[model samples]
Target: MNTVVSYIKEWQQALQSEIQFLKKFGSNKFLVSNGRLLSTDGSYSYYFETTTSLRIPVGSSVRLEWGSMSQQGRVLSSEGKGVILALEQSFGDLISEATLFHDPWELLDHLIERLDEIKKDKQKRLRVKKLMDPSMPANHPLEKIKSNVHELVLRSKYNPVTFVWGPPGTGKTYTLARTAANKYFQEKRVLILSHSNQAVDVLLGELTDFIQKKDRFREGDVLRYGFGTGERTDNRQAITTTELLQNQDPSLAEEKEKLLEDRKLVKQDIARSFSKRDTNQLLELETKIARVLEKIRQKEIEFVKDAYIVGVTLAKAASDPAIYEKTFDVVIIDEASMAYVPQAAFAAALGKRVIICGDFKQLPPIAASRDSLVTKWLREDIFHRAGVVDWVNDGRLHPHLFLLEEQRRMHPDISAFTNQYIYHSLVGDHESVRKSRNKIVESAPFPNRASILVDTSFTGAYCLTERTSQSRINIWQVLLSFHLIHESYLSGLRSIGYVTPYRAQAQLMELILEDLYQEQRLNADIIAATVHRFQGSERDVMIFDTVEGAPQSRAGMLLTGKDSERLINVAITRTKGKFIHVSNQAFIRRHVFQGKTLRQLVEHQVKQLQTVETKDIGKWIKHQHLKLQWMHARKLENVFQDIETARASIVISLPAHTRLSPEWLEKLNNREKIVKLTVISESEWMELRPDHRVAEGLSFPFIIVDQQFLWLGLPLEGTKEIQPPFVAARLDSEKVSEYLLSQFITRE
Candidate 1:
């Protein structure tokens, strides 16, 4: 263990140095070494005898040697300097942290302690009574069911916050509707919201049905209603799952048609090449057509209109804050993780008591660095906040609750896969549910079950694809797929949803639904997507695409951040038996790691650790600075690695350094090929000429030019046109070495 720990620590130090180097250098080249040393910041002619010690320039001549760790060599020189910033080494620190997540039993113990306290508090508030009613109990029939619903509502009402950790197929939405109905019947005005439109529709339907069927509501009345369906006089259009399907523009249909036609043309071209017996032309044509077809297919996404407009309209709906402030007694928010801060703020304005439901293990919100409040707080400053600290320390906070050891959705096999890949600590073939009917699936085996296909393909590429901006990899695709699969697998029952965080993703889904209606004329399914789509919502089936990408492979791919998470919750909670993912591997890898390749770094470090000696611990583990502590380095590295390994194949983390000549740099900066120059004085301005330095191991190509050609040389005026060449040198020290080095080394 000490040996392992020591290796982790050493990797941590190396990683820190790498980060500092990157920050200082920005995009400059660096020197790297595994077991090699060179002249300190000077030209070194004494090259190593072995391949591992080869003093190659950073960006140039450093050939990548693939082999077992022991056989591989580290870099010695880059750009004539002895420092190639090792990003892969920097990423190794995170790997150590990931290995520590094998057990959360301590966390569970803390939760159980607080849960008792919560229960005791509830007991003190209630007056226990025995009900005796053969035909009708003294208490209402609704009260006879699960006390968990009322308990959840009560928790929210008193604390003004509560978390509902609804796993797949647990009837999360139905329970939410019942809870809201009870609150409403108790004269508490309740507002239900979800992040996805589909979840919202499910919640509205369940609540509306409860009001209409069970409560004996009369016809031609607004007593029974959901958010966007049927009729309402509250100036609110309850957008039914069906009504939402009609609001999209028909332009998407036309775009999709044109794309199909172009695809046909490409196929024909390929066929023609093959018919002519030209294998080379056929292959080239096939490649070109594939690229073209990808472009056409990405043109199908449409905006989810109603969902987006709701936020703006919500502002307009109730001009006086009091309308929302006092009208609702309790507000339930679903898919809280997907909700943006602004939307959450707006929802908070509605009432004092708000119930938020979501799982943090799934997708997190997609936000710019500046705007990502949740991620920023959770990652960096969470422990400083008292509320957050209480949750982490006590494991029982008012805002969140762990749904300990319960899972209802997924067949045994599919659920197991999801548990291994996505969710953790909850669900599965645990002892508690071994004999219970709550097994993953009734009869479907892992191998033969109707699989929730996890497709990781991009439909769009930047150079070739063009489509309606809103539909390009919208998160709603997961929600729609969830409904399609869940309804096919789970019961005919649809669920209820509550909006939380915000409604932005749901709005996007609406647009897609409209396009679907126009193109497929298939509107028989009972699914809904809404802002904050489905909080306090649950169903029988769920599908999610956490990876974002272009409409086709041509447009490229990326991850689905906040949007995917919200939709995933909606998809899982909406179904009782299934969960699926249609994703782009490249997209997820890019987004989850966010510029840092965590998985690769961790794996590399772990491998290194496996071979280290026990006594070298001080070299790796010891850190003088508080910020560079062993645990901190370990945790960050592990997170990076977890995401990296989870979706490894499709994503790549580029080398930290790239090499370029001064001429090439100028060209790149200027966005052109030719170098521009204006000369004046003979001494200051010189013509472009070859500067040949024949020093061993220090020669390369050089083009000596005047200061006038360099952008950093001097400033120009209207009358003077140019200044002196004090800033630029025709043959600098670095250039001279490069010219000489080229003479000694192989050009390639």
Candidate 2:
């Protein structure tokens, strides 16, 4: 037998043995029931019934799995009836740990030893080679990174590992796809891996799209494994490795088709046997189908080994014995920083060259304890470790590591903070980002300010509610987000998101936003998510609600850590157009704030807001020598009051519903001779009802006091009462005011 085949067979046997062990010893089935809580002891007991007579030693760690969720707990007590278990934490924690499996400590140790042996062997050393196509110009958005990737691939011939540092919005996925396509076109077999199935799918989608656009990719050029066939409905031309391999040989395809037809006939026969109650024939047909499936599986493995490119999640690749049988020229791992070291190393072992793309500054691999020595040695990602090592001093980065500098996702002002503070001036500005900044400035209510920090220092504005052991929800922040959302929509920004650090706060904001959406007061498309959940995504406008307000110590505790700084960095960089930080000033001042990036932003916004003097509508009208339009029936008294004090000429367009007495009209007509008051009855305004509400619950009863400021009201349609919760912003541009004016105009 061939060496590779023998090694694969051994690995397969080991996997089977492990599976059998888990089935017999690791997995435990129990009948679970809620136990009564003791009021005096404050201890809640849960009862579990064992399927078989067993001994669950006290203090032993165990996991309870049911209905797509699992929870970690300890055996508090055990008896013949069942065992009592005390949960580690909340129910959600249990669901999160459901994906957690037994650590492959022994396999990882052996792989590391093999890696060491490979590293020490001079004959097995890598030799660097330049890109086969270095003449390809950098024309794509991520072409610079792609070029760097080619260099990395060249270096990978000499080095086992190559790293790409892709900051947020730096087009890491695009670079990975382009590089993979380049290698595939060269007829180099490649294997793509990621810890997340979603990440793998994203890269696969990008590759498929790239292949479809180019003439080089054929039907059987790329094969996707692990992902369901139904999931690729959008790209039906793409086939699995098994199907591609089967298609390569007409004999195999013919045989497979014949077997499939035979299996169908056998199934029909089994149905007939079942209906006739013939158990013998049913069992025989079942055996036949099983044999046919085994043949199909073998054929799939054979085809998979021959594919030019294959994609799978790290977990799938690590467990599937067939993946170990073939050697890949290049192994590209996306989101490598989030992968455990062992998982990434196992995938890397399957290829000669390893190209890893990820941002280590965003989120690290989830672990039970970062302080654990075993976790630090085993779970710390290779990409993350490589990033921390100062390879730039030795000028070795060209061959082994590529740090993508240009960020295209955030406005200059927004990216500047991340560039200066988190990245230490390593990130460069993109020309497109400058254009985006200018465009947002041209339309912003306060165009000069790209970042705004709302001061919730007032008594009621900084209130924080502790909802869980790990989460806190801020009411003031949610309310401020609503106001910002309204303003953002009016500014023509359709894509908006609200990000918070606490899951509870995120849930609360979602509830509030949902209610606003149902009432037609806010856009339903706007998303609210925790910072971790919103990673790898960007929005035109981002409202970050740091739900850490007084008491000062609680807020300090939440914001004073490295993890908190990473969360802040991610939240700040998610905006391409506008960034708003809603937090209490008191909390910000506590302990000088460890992270300089967040501190600088808070100070900048405080200075900007302080420089701009606050002016009400009445005060604004007094300063302008312009025409003012007072519309609506219920707000006429307040409008008249502001107009009485204003120096500007006023034009009042009243709704047809306003039944002004004849005497009042005569007085107004007489006064029109002296005062520059032109009364225009807007007959069409009467036809505008609540059913004409636009976007959220924003209506057309706005007070346009010239082109300086527009006071837009939020009212539920068909309601008699108009609420005071209205958005008042300075209208710096006449085009914006004209847009608002157009909404109230009647068709001629």
Candidate 3:
């Protein structure tokens, strides 16, 4: 058994023994309020209070004793106050909370013992083979999988523990599926696990579809285990092995159908009694339905023992005693980065070969206490810890670790920023993702464009409370994001996602989006979630609201960690076509010294904007009607060649500082005699001050070739550096060219 499960079992036994002892000798008559306990026996009463507000820890079992009856319950609290002391009627009324007390420190002692064992175990060290299978063909099943070279290398290594570093949109699930399928096809029993049931279900669905398409496995070969009733009923494809077994057995299937039908009848009877307000009949029917459901559950568990390939959530799989008896050849853990180290270890202990698939750079494991030593120690996943020392650095990956570089989800525009800032430009570029197939009913103002930055420029205000260090949403940001959503909906671009760093902001956005959805102003399926919640998901368009707007305060504190950088990466990469970042530019600039990813992104956007404005090359080419000329002193031969192709006369100009070869000057002089060639120099042109040049439509060393085409050569000045020392051509603008020529010929 794994250390965590063993510790849990020991704790449970200790709790049970303590409960038995308390029942035998402890006081029965007690009063409880606000998680405080006061024992009262006849005339005497003793109130037990601590220095701090008393809190009953969640998941700790509580037992109550009265007369001949003993009842067990759990403590459910709100802000350290025990709201429901007794919970159920069987547990009786509020009793002494002191009797319910069990220090988790005792539980931690067992956990500490386990941690020590893990630290000392040399067998737990990750091992990898030095060589791969040389006989494997080029067209092997693994090769057919569209994964990166890193993934293929990792799959080749015969490692006890292998890690797949899957950044956002990097096909982590697909890689896991391929690996698991390969193992299964090789006659190896595989156990697939994940942090959440949803993740497990997704992997299971993908695997089942993949194997079915290949005709490699029978219908009952792979089984989904430990899914709850709702999950079993809702997902037909992911029916538990027990359900499949029951269906295959004629007697069991009939009995199960009869129970379901009887339960349905009871539900129908209860619905009818609700109209008549018959309380007794409704109560009896509800009890009948509950009994039938329990029977069905028990029968399902009984048949699950025969499954060959099983998929389950980590906690459920670890807790199942039957799983410990059977060893699998390979255990595949999806979303491994989000699984706590101990939880992952528990899952990893079940298999000889462990494969962990997840992106450590997306989101770390969630923890309850940031200050606790145990919590802090357990926050880092095994995959992340392994990567820290030996994986994916300096263009070389560890033999056992695979870094998936090709992201097939986000558009190149959306992925470029994340690729450069987060992945160090190691991610592969798939140009096909740039074209979004989402149907747009109405074209937005900026339709089918690259990622954009919506610079709010410190227009919003942020709130930070003492209760939490994180900043809350600014009302202005919510309004601005809502406006964007409205515009997106109007433009027919649906599948929008709104992501924020703060929970309060996400909640507010959710409310605003819901209202807009109800009013038919926004898409009904729009999602608003925090960055952590939005990880491992994607959308057609994503709007990020960086809630830190306060410039004077230490707003930088929130975005100053590797985790924050990962959050920013996940947020920006979730969109396929458009990434709309809403942040205060002034605030970001002020705290840019913090070296946060968001600030870096904003700075990149700023540079891109400046480059686009200064060098409007596309705008120049669009207006020039295919008749354009580029002149440079270093490339005079190329310029002469370009001038020779002009159907009409060509005009050439040079600044005072520009020096040309005598051969080029003779070639230009000869061209002047052959065709209408006009050459002008800065000194020969009309003299005008910098301010007057714009009004006169005249620039230094100006030339008007073919009467209709104008080339203005302006020198680089101030902060703007000129390339080629030339301005864009003006085509079909005779008036502007005529004015410049008239002024140039008439020297002052």
Candidate 4:
């Protein structure tokens, strides 16, 4: 199959998805209703201030609409209430107030433009000739992928597209930096770009460190010419473009001042013209201004032309007219999995040779389109779209793909899980991790182990959700987590994270942890967030709250959907020292049988894995025998089996006047053990007694059998004729039943 032909179709789908994303999250999601111009960086861009706190990521494109004038620009930088936008149209004056919009169309337009050019390009050095069969000539041994990135870049003369799959903590960024710096030493122009601004700064910062230590390098040689999230960088001040033009080079600075001053005078002269020949004079003056602007553009280009390494976001490279004028020997995309197809395509076209770096098993581009084709082409990263994932899964390695598995962020045992389960044992941890495994401090529950599965079934921490919301929360689990987190804190593990699939659980933990840390005056570094928010980050200790055990009894859609092993892989592999997974063992096993992603998690954690984080947290572990089923529309026969088989006790929360069936009575009579039973009903219906309890505003229609099995959702005890058409799910875990009983039984 012609991969370029597919990309043409994928390109169209991605544009459509971009439209859908904007339509869905346009005005409300990104609103700058009232903002003012703060300052201008150069003739090409203006710095604006928003009235509200804005979190627009750097390098995002935005639209400014006020009165009859509407313009688009790239956000060069973004701070709390300030954003610097490099607009297509420049203004000498600033507006006190204007409405700014967040539109990604401009970013797509650049990609589309570059894609069209790629389709027309004929050179083998510029574009991949056989995209379906990409190759890297004279590639290094698989063991030296991390060490030989620069050599691969130099050796891949005929091949244009090369991919590097760097899993978490594999030092991909460091490898990228070393490659860029080494290329600089060889006098090769290197352009580094990423999907996010923060990533740009991080890479630029790393690049700065490496180049600064070099004997031949000096300040202003490498420039961080764009906006990133970080307010500060370790790079020298002269590394910025503004610093280079205004301070680093004296001759360029003098020429820029003269041209700008001349342009300013000409604009004033045109504004003052009034004679009958004023039109001619105005045209002449405008011509003068245009000439001076060209001179300024040339000088700016000259300043950039001398730089060996330039770092920016893909949007910046696409939007900045200056970028299209230049070419690079090597183009590197860091965190490429988070990049859209167009971004990668555009960057690929910018350089004769390309290096796309990322872990496809992590986050892909975050788009809101539900179209399957759009999701495949627009949302999936380059590695996925180009069949690297397919080849790897089929036990075959792609010629163009290089793998880096020597990670130092996770323990060897913890890395083994992702190594065996996620990557199919294709790569293993480095010796650093192997040696560091035994150095772990014996923290309370996590003594000498890197990972643990905290089975909530035995701890009475049943999962729960509200009547109206799907964001599940297990209060008992939260409490147990907080206790363990606190223990880890006291044991000197500072970098901790409590991550769950539900926002409600994260928020709840946030509030409690915030209050507790403040109350104790403890300097806590713990973070609680959803699974998606924890990507591209690592922690010394992490608690994976696999919230699943409620009545829904199903795994998360993002966890069980197509190719969802990536997300689950990210969730489980973000910890370095210790990992704790709190989940309902029975629910996942019963309901998570369909998806390969969730099933692998179950088989690996429930059966194969043996290391438990902490034995102390198992204070509530108590195994009890039970049986349960889900019945819909029909109860079949022996509907009262829960009551009939109760050996210890039965807590029936139903109408006081309700009577038992004959089959239940016969079974109870035949049992040798005397079972105690309590009936809970409305206060007005039943008086407070030892056998009969009165409850106010409490739900009752559930029967807790020996505090192990729970009969819930529908009343199957009444006559079959009076039964309503309803669905019911019987929980068979002892801890779940006890937890449910505690929730239903009102003591006050």
Candidate 5:
């Protein structure tokens, strides 16, 4: 590791080694250097000099990884075990501070001069070339998982394509960024794309943060480096947003024309079918056709905008005429599962290299497309049709890189639940990915509990009708609570969702949210009417108030199929914390089908116990305990089993247990639990518990009232004897005394 480094006294001399590495080995060499740095959990970077005294900008990322790398050399420096990162500064600002450092062309000129010195010394040039080559394992310190993928991408240079699929909190976005950054430093222009506006915004924020770092490129330098958007005004990318709307070029016009023609044909077919149908047939056709036509139109509009915006933006930047000019050396697309093949093709056509990233298990395109867009786009067009098969087979962009593993984001308990419920395959071998093993799982399991009280006969169809006073009171109570609770943020907050099964119920839910907001001060942003409107969407807190209007009939079970699944999913997932289900407890007891109860499915085990057979009985009990529906029961049993297994290593003593005495039972039955069956005179029966309050004792099963109803507590049914906990009452001030006296004192 001895070296005779020559000081040519120029910036070009400082970067001679890096420049030589790039010219001989191409962009892959630089990728190897940066890829290693990008893998770290924290940020780190270094500014290094070549063998010829040329200066090159090299940064090591320490923030992205969990640990640090041991000392290998000054080539890749470490702060203790941690990596080093180059702080990003804007070009305009950096240049304002130090003029010479901001000029890439000037730096380029100096570095070229320094290479001339290396060319003069044959042995020195050879030694530097060997170090600059990135083929050696020691050259890159990326995590083993990432390093393997990078190598695959390098080997498959001709036509590389990779798929990284995992559930939420898996650091999917971070992996995409790291791969893109690695390619970027190699002087390869890269593109980052996302199917969702929210996804795009999030990735944009992350990239902006990285670019704004002091050691990283300055904002101005990034713009110069093709990383910056056109311009910003009102906190938005002004040029890009404007151009996204008005890309009225011929290609765009052609796509629009095709869409309109397709719509016309679909409409014509629907009309023909309607004309030939009977009244009933025509009705069904009308509904189906309307839905299909609406979806088609939406898809078209989304496509036109998505395709036009990115293409026009890129074209405007590269005003040059070369069709195949390497505008971007590498491109990364997020939410690729939602990206159609045509959209991906359009992006691929513009970039020199491309990377598409998304989780297929989460969601695929719901647009009118007929295929798996990601698979078809990558394999057929990029590899087969384009004749980039060799590159793809070799793990190159002619191929692409696919990541299978995951990093961080979800707690083990939540992740396991999602995997079992949502994913098609199991998450295996990852020891860190397991059910929550903590002693304390939930601090607030039942943060908010609501009980619904229904009338005796349950025939109250007017319970949900807006015209009724009851409905108004219900709405008002919810409105008051919404105002009182400090809930929901407008932006940068977890979403807020509401869901109901019935169409009218859904409509009422919306009315409730809007009315409450109008009547009170609510700083909420987005609200959905039903589960369908909120599907594939998440919120921080959710409120579901079941509407009661249906009479007792089989048809009353309105939730079924996708609607049922959608409602359950929506209600369960809407809150990262507490989920509120506000409906009458009586309604739940009456309306919900009994057999459907999750707990009832567990059958009670009947097993025989005998002397000297205690061990076998215990084993059966243990298995039965494990099968119980309650989570707490399972936890307790597991703990007990663990203790028993540990205790098996040593002997323990037994203590005699005590039994209840006959005298104690006699005292409890005679005095503590005495029952008196007395027959009072017909009129006198009404007088019991004189201290308690009373109501009209309506024929209704339970007392029913609206927001205007207010009672202190349950009242006594009579003016004599023992008291009861609650009394049914309708709170109307004008009839309060009559209603109370009527229940306790019978009319003469």
Candidate 6:
């Protein structure tokens, strides 16, 4: 780690390790194409529709590029397949040409290449070591009450790196913004960074408003460096880096003009060359024009260095060239838990003093990588790499870590569970959490309790779960989310969030939600985002859909690791009023054996929760807890038992490889009344039961006895090719059964 080459090797490995492995963990990388103009606000923001809906995590920092013209925007929300982007600048000339989108991660290699040079600074290098392994003793939370520890940390000369474990709704952004504002007012250079552009905007919105009201931009520049649009704050004065260089800095503006002139000349030269039939010169001229544009970009970013207080995404800060030229008095990295370790290192290595603010218990970087090199350093959050999170997990305190105990967001009832397990008696509820006004139970969404777990087990579990390759879909969970969302909408809740672990599941649920919105069953404001994306945003009513009954012997990667704990904690803490996790208790107990987060939730919360069972589907469906028709059948005889009762029709879509006992089918055929039995399986199964057609691509199999609705099947020990005697559950609801049926069978 001493040599730059060695550090770069390890860093590069962390960055590239996922390339060689199948990504079974982390956030789904955002990549979608062919965006067209949808709508504009007549001023700044624009919405563009992509041809296909990607599981684009809303609020992600995205770049919309067309041919050569491009603009950066923060995704405000998604309008179906379209994304509502608050662009840094309006592209009025945007034509119907295909536009492409990419994430901020695309530009990070430049930052990585520059890190070695950054480490060349002796003071900064020493600071990074101190940050990585600081010997500073942790101060008591009472010490923060007694003294201005927040301010002290911001200005600390000795302890260069500080950790603030800011749990959900703990005013992490508020505290950081105020502290950053204080630094700016005190004439200390401060750069505040977060993992996402949305987070940056949120913090900057608070900081800008507070500072603007205090001094009204009288003394210094409180600049928003990387992003163009700040919808919440008045961005007219504190413009972005490009805007500042365009209007304020005379030298950079002049350079831009010269570059523009040079580009114009190059274009003219190309035109003249075309007229003269000088085809070979075209490439040279285009390259010259590109160089001029690059020079122009370099000139434009010059404004990035002069800001008194700059707020930007960590990726933006690291990759932004002007940031490399300047050093800050303090660098505060908010959302350190979600942030990659290198992101924290970028801050720790840049500033003389640093404040790493995040809750390690919350989700880490959603990396698809499981490599030890990447997991230990690159993808893991700074809190984990620092080993303080381990200390807390082991019932020990890390000296330099400051754990924020009091949360003002969740009601006392909801925060009670997290305080006991996740925080281990270290955290408490603020008085505001206990306020009668914050009584969510008194509200419409959950009339009984502040939180509840819709145990899918008691609600006639399905033989075949609404699950796909990545545990992406549990139709019951998806439908349950839709039902809850609809109920919340009817009850007059506008800000509702639905969090799931898989991006595919989120996108699928979004489709159902869109259908619900179309039918006027739900509002357009309801957003279905991944657990990773739901952080930093508060909702009035929230639903955490843990994709249940993972088909395999192992519950998917989403339910394992400390990252899973973080995901659960974040989803739990995001709700201000009411929260419900539509979960499969049976799966968590048996399959999630490696993880304790889900098991603990079921074990503890169920004791206090009103056990809403599925003995009757009609009643459960009304409340969004469905399933009664489909029954759990582990043995083929149990499946035969249900098939015998089917007087109308028997639709069988079992695993193609399943070797059904011939006697079972013979008995099924010899029923008192000859009923139509449709077997949708591989061609081989069709050969045995010629009454049915072939289910070409069916993976998980099931039988819907006397029902048109499909019941999914999962064996106790599931495999790609599930053998006999696998455990499968039943879903009885007719709603969306046709949908699940469509996936299994190809109708003639």
C-alpha TM-scores of all predictions: 0.35, 0.58, 0.61, 0.68, 0.37, 0.70
Roughly what TM-score does model 2 have, to 2 decimal places? 0.58
lDDT of 5 by residue, 360-439 (tens): 43333332212233233321222232333344345443213244445332334333333444332334224552332121
RMSD of each: 28.5, 17.0, 21.3, 13.3, 29.3, 10.3
Candidate 6, 533-593: lDDT as tens digits: 7877888778888876644355666767656777788888888878888887776787776
Judged by TM-score relative to the true structure, which candidate is superior, 4 or 6? 6
Alpha-carbon shift of residue 686 in model 1 (angstroms)? 45
User: Which runs of model 1 end up more than 4 angstroms from their true locations?
Assistant: 1-146, 194-200, 216-322, 325-327, 362-407, 420-422, 428-447, 450-748
Work out candidate 1's RMSD over C-alphas: 28.5
Record all residue pairs in model 2 with backbone atoms less than 3 Å apart, i.e. clashing.
126-158, 127-157, 520-696, 520-697, 521-697
Window of ten residues with lowest summed lDDT in model 3: 126-135
Local distance difference test, each candidate: 0.34, 0.56, 0.55, 0.65, 0.33, 0.64
The list of candidate 4 runs beyond 4 A from truth reads 1-6, 25-52, 55-101, 117-151, 154-158, 231-238, 242-303, 437-441, 458-470, 518-524, 606-748
lDDT of 3 by residue, 107-146 (tens): 3333334434434443432211111111222222455446
726, model 5: CA deviation in Å?
Answer: 13
The model with the greater TM-score, 1 or 6, is 6
lDDT of 6: 0.64
lDDT of 2 by residue, 128-149 (tens): 1111111223222333334655
Question: How many clashing residue pairs appear in each of the predictions shown?
Answer: 104, 5, 1, 1, 82, 27
Can you give the lDDT of residue 612 in candidate 6? 49
Model 3, position 110: C-alpha lDDT score? 38
Off by over 4 Å in 5: 1-144, 147-159, 220-327, 367-416, 424-445, 448-495, 499-507, 518-526, 529-538, 542-575, 579-748
Which has the higher lDDT value, candidate number 3 or candidate number 5? 3
- Candidate 6 scores a C-alpha RMSD against the true structure in Å of 10.3
